[model samples]
Target: MATPVSGLCSLKNKVALVTGASSGIGADVARLFASYGCRLALTGRNMEALQQVTDKCVERGLDKDEILMIQADFEVESDVRKTAEQTIQKFNQIDVLINNAGVYLNDSVENVILENFDRVFVVNVRAPLLLTHLLAPYLIKTKGTVVNVSSIVGRVSMRGLLTYSMSKSAMDHMTRCIADGLCFD
Candidate 1:
């Protein structure tokens, strides 16, 4: 019986923190991780959506207790911190950090403003950095991995996604730096 999302790595019983887990890629990742038997800590701004995702995980055989749902908005730095604290409080150890939360503004340099740019950066770049920082100790101890969900927009410029593109580019760099800094061998 082969599963849909095959894995070269073993994920059974591992703990994963997936941001933006209410929808899109985040929700899909949560479902896949649950299928692999990874304990899940999912964060998103919408509880109703989060619960729907949770239901899918439950359908995948994760006990309701095996999953922790956090209603968080990455625009708030404190929410980012609280996400880490809450996940750690529940799971004690985190084996995977999925920085998938993000905000996108359809604006070009011509119309871009600090408020919108900051919102994009805070969620796309800063949230991942802060979560990695807060969970560094546990990640180090467990030799865990960080998956920053970045888009091609980061590398290829688009007219209406000026701020989003820049933030994702920064995210690309952040992922590389984190991988290097966390190298144990």
Candidate 2:
């Protein structure tokens, strides 16, 4: 027998924070959530792109104030912390945390510069860790869920993207550990 969907998944009156909301899968996810009536906090380094996505959310019947855009580089810890703090202040609670901010250095470690690898780690791994740490307490208060954007490379090895894959491997393991820890009685 198939199970019926619950109203809890409707996302109505819920608040979601999506990093890397400017483009790609993150943008699409934000749109889908908006269609389900979720108020969104969209973050990206590109102000124009973030506003464009927010505009679409408003057009889709989300209130003008329902969408908040934080334009900051996810590689910075201060920016990550501020994004979470501002979202909590605006929405009073966050129903979902989408750690969609990430980078793909499409090169092997042999050819990849040290600085480039560091930036990839900062954006892909460190940023999500810091953001989740900041939001864990708030999420606990609401029993909220977290959605992390990880790549298939984490499961299947590829020719390039060695560091990127490693970071995602760490993220996948972290997700499992967190899920285990957050499972309630």
Off by over 4 Å in 2: 1-9
Q: What do the candidate models score in CA lDDT, each in turn?
A: 0.91, 0.86
lDDT of 1 by residue, 1-185 (tens): 12755462388899999999999999999998998888999999999999999999999879999999999999999999999999999999999999999998899878889899988888899889999999999988888888999999999988899999999999999988878778743
Model 2 TM-score relative to the real fold:
0.92
Question: What TM-score, over all chains together, does every model reach?
Answer: 0.96, 0.92
Strongest candidate by TM-score: 1
State residue 86's C-alpha deviation in candidate 1, in Å: 0.9
